[model samples]
Target chain A: MIGWTRRNAGDQSNSEAVIQLTNVDYTYQAGSPFAATALHDINIRIRKGTLVGIAGGTGSGKSTLLQLLNGLLLPTGGAVKVLDHTLLPNMQKPRLNALRRRIGLSFQFPEQHLFEDTVEKDLMFGPMNFGSSRKEAQSKAVEALKSMGLDEALLKRHPLTLSGGQMRKVAIASVLAAGPEIVMLDEPTATLDSAARRELIALLARLCREEGRTILMVTHRIEELMEVADEWIVMHEGRAVFQGDADELADRSEELDHWGVAVPEQLRCWAEWTARLPQLAALPLPRTAEDMARRIEEAVHGFEKCESTNIASKEGSQQESAQELNDQADSSMDAPYRHEKEVSACVTS
Target chain B: MRDKLIIGRMIPTGSRVHGLDPRSKITAMLLFTAALILSNGWPQLAALTILSILVLTATKIPAKTYLRALRPLRWLMLFVFLFQLIAGAGNGTVNLAAADPLLWSGTWGPFTLTSAVLSSALLAVSRMALLIVFTAMLTFTTTPSMLSRGVEGMLKPLSRKGTGAERFSLMMRLALRFIPALLEEAQTILKAQAARGADYEEMKLKEKARLLLSLLVPVTVGAFRRAEELTTSLEARGYRIGAPRTAYRQLIWRSADTWFTLLFALLPVGALLMRLTV
Candidate 1:
C-alpha cells in the first residue's frame, strides 16, 4: 500500500531518474474497433543502476510496459520519459535509434529473432546499427559473448545450431553488445532450466552491480528474482498494483496472491519469524535462505537467554528452569512451520 | 503493419451472415466474383458496388477493417487503374460512338484521353477493390476451420474414391491457420530487431528492404520449426492424413443458407440481363 498511493512518483528529483512514466496509458491499435487498452494511468520511476523485477501473470501488461519504455510503442494518452527524451501523445515521433542504442530491450524468446548465419554477426548487429565501427563492434561482440559465459569459439557457428540455453545466451549477448545504459528484458529465463536461469540472473546482476547498467526484468515467478532484485513492481490487470523495495513487498505479501503473484517461500518464513519474535522486525528482511536461517537462530537464542534470566530472578528453582527449557523446546518445534521447512530445505539443497 | 492485416481475422457478431453455412458463404463469394467481373458499364458496376457494401454491412464487422484489407493493395490497385487508362482496350466491348465524347483526337497524338476510357479505368479499380472486400468478408465472417470443412464438403464429389479432397482441404486449412500466426511472429521479430537498434520504421527504403530480407530468414525458419512441432503433435495424437476421421462439427445447411446464397445468385443473373440489353 505504501507504493500504491505514491501516485506522484514524478515529484522525485530528476538526477537519479533514468526512466519515468507519468499518467501513462497505452492501447493496442488505438482508435480501431479491435483496440485494447494494455496499460492505464501507470506512474513509475526507475532510478539508475538498480535491478527491478516486474512480476505479473499472463495478460497483465508486463510486456507492454517494456515496449513503452523502449519507444517500441508510444503511450497513447500520457508521457513516457526514458533517458533524456520525452514522448507524448500525437507528437511527431522523432528517430529513436540514438535513444534505442542506450536502452536495450530483449523480447520474450529473443532467440527466435536471431537470423544471422553466425553467432558473432548476430551479436554485432546491434552495435553496427548504432553506428559503431566494424572493428569496435567486433570486439564488443567478443566482450559480450565472454560476459554471457559463452565460449569464444562458438562465435563462428550458426546461432540456430547451438543448444537452447546457449542460443538464449547468445541472443542476450547480442542485445548487450551495444553497451546500453539501461537493459530491459521480458521473461528472459522463461523456458530456461533452473541452473541456466540462475546463471543468466547472476550475469544480469553482475551487469547491474559492476557496469552500473539499470536492468528491468519481467517475470511471473518472483521467487527466482527474490535474491537479486533491488526493487519489485507487481502488475495486475494493466495496473502496477505494488512497487517498492523487498521489505514493503514482504509487508504486503498477503496482497500479492490477490494480485496473481505467488509469495516466495523465503518471504513467508521471514514473516513467520517476525511474527513469533517481534524483535526481528527491527532488522532488514532477509533476501536469501541462509540469511533468514541465521537471523531466526540469533533472535531465538537471544529471546531464550532473556527468558532464562527473568525466570532465574523471579523463582530460583530447578523445576521452573526445567519447565522453561521444555517451553523453549515446544516453541522451537512450533517455529518450524511448513514455510520454514520449505526454506530450510532450500538452504540444504 | 500487423494491425493493418485483416486477412484471416474473423470478427464474430452473431449476425445472419455469421450464422450462414460456410458452404453457402463460399458459393456466394464465387457468384459475387462472377457478377463483378461480368458487369462492364457504369450502371451495372454501381449496382454491384451497392450490393457489395450491403453484404459487407450484414456481417456486422466495422467497415474500417474491410478498408484496412485494401490498404496493403492500394499501390497495386493504382497500377491496375493506370494500366487500364493507358491501355484503353474497351473498344470491342463498348461502342465508342455510343460512349462519351472523345476529348482529344489530334493527328500528333495517337493516344487519346476520353471520358469513356477514364470511366473504364475507374471501373477496373472499383472491381479490384470490391474483389478484395468480398474475399475479406468471407474470412471475416467464417473461421478457418469452418471454411476448410466447407471446402472439403464442396470438393467431396471430386474425390469420391481417394483422399484428395481432404488432403487439399487440410492444406488450405493449415495455410489459412498460419497466416495470422506467421504475421504475429513476423511482428514479434520486427519488434525484437527494432529493440536492437534496427528500427524498421526509421530506416530508409533500401535499409527497410535489407531489414525485411533479414527478417525473411528468421520467419521461414520459425515457420519450419513450428511446422515440425505441429507434425510431431499431430503424430503423437495419432492423426493420420485421410484416416476417415469423423467430423467434430457437422455443418448443417439450413434454409437460411439457401436464402443467403439465393441473394447472391441474383447478382450474376442481373449482370447477364444488363449485358444482353446493353
Candidate 2:
C-alpha cells in the first residue's frame, strides 16, 4: 500500500541515526507575560540518508524544533543528541562550538547569512572557517556553485548582484560547501517562484539520494514534499501531533485540518470522490494522485454490477424523476453541510 | 518593500572603484578626512572640497541616489550648523554693517550675526556634506563582507599582540546581516500587537515607553532564538570560527588602487605644505 511501514522497511540498515531528540521540551523565558511554551515532549529519530519533512502551521514550534536538532538550541527539559554529541540545557560554550562543525544549517532567508563581496568568497567562508586549505576551499566553492546550477563566472560577482532565486541558491551552496553530513533547512523555498522551488526540491532530493546525506527540511507546503519525504512529522501547537510515513498522513488528514494545517488538495479530492461512491468506501485511503486514481478505477469496476442493475431499474421507472434525483445528488456534493456529512460518514462508518 | 531596502545596496558594476581592495579605499578615506581637518586656509579647503567632488562624480551612481543617501543625516547636519552658528565664541564686531539691518539687530550676548560666522558655518556644512558623500561612495562600491575582511586583513599585523580582530570583523558582518531581519521581525510584532488593540504608537509618552519596554522582552528573546537557530545551521554546515582556512576570492591590488592611494596621500601632503608655506 506504500504506507509508512513499507517505506521505512525498504530503507537500508547501517545508515546510522544522525539526530535523536528524546522527550524534548522547550519553554520561552518567563520575564515576559506572553512567554509561552514553544515545544513539548518531542521525541524524534532521524536516520541517515533520508529526506525528512517537518510540516507545521505558523507558531507550531517548527523553528524551535529545527534549532534543537543541530544543537543550536538546548532543550529546556530533555536531551538532544546529534552525531554522538548530546546537549542538555545550560551546556558550556566550548562543547557547543565542537558540535557546530558537523552540522550545516541554512537559515530561512537568502539574505540573512550572505555578507560577502563575491559569490565565491561567501561560499568558501564556511569551509575556510573550518580550517580547509585555500585550494581545497576554492574547489569546494566551485563544486557547490555547480551543484546549485550557478555559473563559474559568477564566482567573481557580488552575491547581492544575483537575481532573487540565484541568491537563494548561492546561500544554500555556501552551506553545502562545508559538506555537513546532516543538512537542515528551514523553509528554503518560502519566497521562490514555482520553477525555483521545483529546482531546489530536486537538488535537495538528489543530495540525499546521491550523497546519502540526511536532510531535514521544514516546509509549510506538505504537497511539495509528498514525493521526496521518507518520513512526515506534523506538529500542532507545540507538540508532535502526528509522526509517520507519507501514506499514514492520509489517515490523519481530518485531524491535520482541524489543527489548522491546509490539507493537500489531492487528498481532499480523493476523500470527496470516495464519499459519493458506495463501493469505493471500503478501500484504503490514498495519499498521492496516482494512488487515488488507481483506487478510483478499482472502485468503478466494483460498482459496475450494481450500476448496471440500477440503470435497468431506472429504465423501468419514471426516467425523468430518476434523472432529477441524480442531478440533485451531484449538485448537493458542492454544499458545505453535505461535504461535512459525507466526510463524517466516511470517517465513522 | 524589499526593493526599498535593497536600493542603495552595493552592486558589483565592475567599475574601477568597485575593483579596488576595500583596505586601500579605507586608508584613502582616512587620509582624505585628515586633509579636511588639517586645512586652515580657504585655498586648502577649496582643494579638499574639489577633490571630494571629483571622486563623487567618478562613482557613476546617479546624483539623485547619492543625494538620497544624505536624507538620513540631513537633520544632524542642520543641528551641527545651527549649533556652531549660535554658540561659537566670536569677536564682538558688526562685520556685516552694510548687510541687512534686521540681522544686525539680533544679538545673543557678545555674539553678533556676521558674515564671518555665516561663512564659517557654511564651510563646516560643506565639509560635513563632502565627508558623508565620500563615505557613502565607499560603502556603495564595496560589499559588507569585503569591507569586513579588509578590516580583518588590516588588523592582521596587530594579531601578534593578542587582539581578536578577526572575531570583531565577523561580528560586524553578522550584525549587518541581522539588522534587516531584525527590523522586519519588529515590524511584524508591532503589527500583531496593533491587531490586538495595543495601539503602541498612539499611546502617551509614558505609556509608549511602557509599551516599548514590553517589546524589548519579546524582541530580544526572539533575536536570541534566531541566533541559536542560525548558529546551529552554521555549525551543521561545518563552520568553525577562528580556524585557519583558505579564501575563494583573494584580494589583489591593481593599478586603479595605486592611483587612488596616491591621490589620497597627495591631498593631505598638499594641505600640510600649504599650512607650512603660509
Best by DockQ: 1
Q: Give a tens-digit lDDT track for model 1, residues A1-349.
A: 0011211234333338899999999899887666899999999999887889999888999999999898888889889999999988878887999999999999999999999999999999999999999999999999999999999999999998999999999999999999999999999998999889988998998898788899999997887788778789999999998889888998898998899888877677778778877899889886655445556665555555565565444434433543444444321223335245543443354
DockQ score for candidate 1:
0.79
Q: Once superposed on the true structure, which residue ranges of model 1 sit more than 4 Å away at CA?
A: A1-15, A306-349, B90-111
DockQ of each: 0.79, 0.01
Candidate 1 matches the true fold with a TM-score of 0.89
lDDT, model 1, position A320 = 51
Error of 1 at A344 (Å): 14
Fill in the DockQ of model 2.
0.01
For each candidate, give its TM-score against the true structure. Answer: 0.89, 0.49
Check candidate 2 and list the clashing pairs: A100-B235, A103-B235, A103-B236, A103-B237, A104-B236, A104-B237, A105-B233, A134-B246
Query: What is the C-alpha lDDT profile of model 2 across A1-349, one tens digit per residue?
Result: 1122224445544567788888889886432222478999998888888888998899999988877765555688888888988888776632443345567777677444455578887787667656688998899999989988888999999876788899899988887887878888889999898778878988888888778788889998887777678888888999988888766887678888876688976557666676667666566554444445545544443354344555554433434433343344321113223334533544454
Off by over 4 Å in 2: A1-15, A30-34, A277-288, A305-349, B1-278
